[model samples]
Target: MNTASPTRKPSRIQKRNRKLILDAALEVFSTHGYRGATLDQIATCAGLSKPNILYYFTGKEEIHITLLNGLMDTWLAPMREIDPEGDPLEEILRYVHRKLEMSREFPRESRLFANEIIQGAPRIGPHLEAGLKPLVDETSTLFEGWMAAGKLAQMDARHLIFSIWATTQHYADFAAQVRVLMGEADVEGGARAHLDMMFRRLLRP
Candidate 1:
């Protein structure tokens, strides 16, 4: 009897290098904003030469915009999952949990994009209009369906979504305050509990 494991995947140094550049760019962009960050900083952060970074990407703006565009889909997906056909409170709470999970795992990416939006999203505007707006519209219709069915509380669906996004994203965007106020140990837990309580208050049935 064969007890061997599955086949190994191919090593992809170029792909890995590109990912390194993207990650380093995310950190740099988050900290310094777009105009403030330089190619040398990103190259050093990725431990690659500036030419090498350019070999993978044309420029810093390209990488930043690529990261922003990639993030748009993921950032929009949790809202897309808010099913009008499913249990109302449960669906909304699941979205809340997903957004929190994203905040935990991808804080730097969150900060990078947040920094862009705070400055008016020059690079991300088309992606936001073409990608994110459509998803929000779909989910707004879903929310409207839930409200009309009497499954959810009466509320402006778009504003409800806007508030949920603003509140959940604030945790990561303002993580410094969260740490100072709550201490490091309970930050994640406190966010979870606080979000639950807030949503429950909004969604009481």
Candidate 2:
């Protein structure tokens, strides 16, 4: 793994180059899908040579895996932000809005993750099972507690989360289709309002 040593801090240049490579790789992987993406494409995109890319990453798979793992964190951040002590419906609606913002701002990342999952998540399934599942289990328990206390509408907490993911990520993962159907309209804004209304109605006590 091209990891920084625990005892040593990476210099500014090293951090910059690594970020350049990863950002380029995200574009390539999102555009081509993992199986179709290549180190050469990433190198070209990064404006770096293959050797430099290799210096930062081992190969295409390593870059892809790194991107996927990092994306899991980005994907899970909003969920992690949920405040158990906050108002339940607002917290959940805030999650919905944050996810929509991610779809708008991180469309490429959304596509990259969607592609990985669509292809059976061969590169990142383990991370999903290990990281995503636990957080989801905990969130589900939280939702269950809220419902039991009459703070939320009773429903399958797991499916509620799944529904939220599907609805929000659709804007990013299916952007081409969305563009074709909706043209250059303010899609994210519309989605935010719609999702807020939908979830509010569904979850409000």
Candidate 3:
């Protein structure tokens, strides 16, 4: 029995309302996390009634999933820009810089994504497997090629990628701790310089 709902294109108002709901949902979900957030909270944040929020999204899970799916592209775009034709060291350092920039500029999105991963990614696990894994695998292959050519230090490509992720995201994910530890100093610029230096030393041929 095929009982799925038919899909229809959204009208102009529908588009605007959907964006409003999603923007509100991001704020709520990012602050409260998936398990802690509620439809009423999202509605209140959006300045829409609970019913109106539900009209745009059937439930909290749908909104969270939509946000994750949409943000994944932006999150992974830096790695996707690592060109094989470019200098290996420069390409990697550029990617690291872009990631650090993202952590500084999009801390909320980073935290939201981190929260999902910390909770075992119950909603996004499938998406990670189907979408993220292939991109990572391709990047890993590129890393191996660079290593084989003696352009990069011989290290585990996967671990190198993981280190980059952890180091860059730590500033954003632990912003409060970082702020307190660093006081009122320029944390972003300092971290950016430190990461650049660290990766350069680590990746040097």
Best by TM-score, which number?
A: 3
Badly placed stretches (over 4 Å) of model 3 are: 1-7
Q: Quote model 2's TM-score.
A: 0.94
Better of 1 and 2 by TM-score: 2
Model 3 lDDT, full chain set? 0.91
Please, what are the lDDT tens digits per residue for candidate 1 over residues 1-205?
1112266443488669878988888889888889999999999999999999888777777888888887777777788777767898899999988998898888887888888888898888888888888888888888878888878888998998888878888888888887788765877888899999999889755
lDDT of each: 0.83, 0.91, 0.91
Candidate 2 vs 3: which has more TM-score = 3
Error of 3 at 67 (Å): 1.0
Measured against the true structure, the TM-scores of the candidates, in listed sequence, are 0.89, 0.94, 0.95
Show how many residue pairs clash in every candidate, following the order shown.
0, 0, 0
Residue-level lDDT of model 3, residues 122-202, one tens digit each, is 999999999999999999999999999999999999999999999999998999899889999999889989999999999
Q: What is the C-alpha RMSD of each candidate to the true structure, in Å?
A: 6.9, 1.8, 2.4
TM-score of candidate 1 to 2 decimals: 0.89
Evaluated at residue 121, the lDDT of candidate 1 is 81
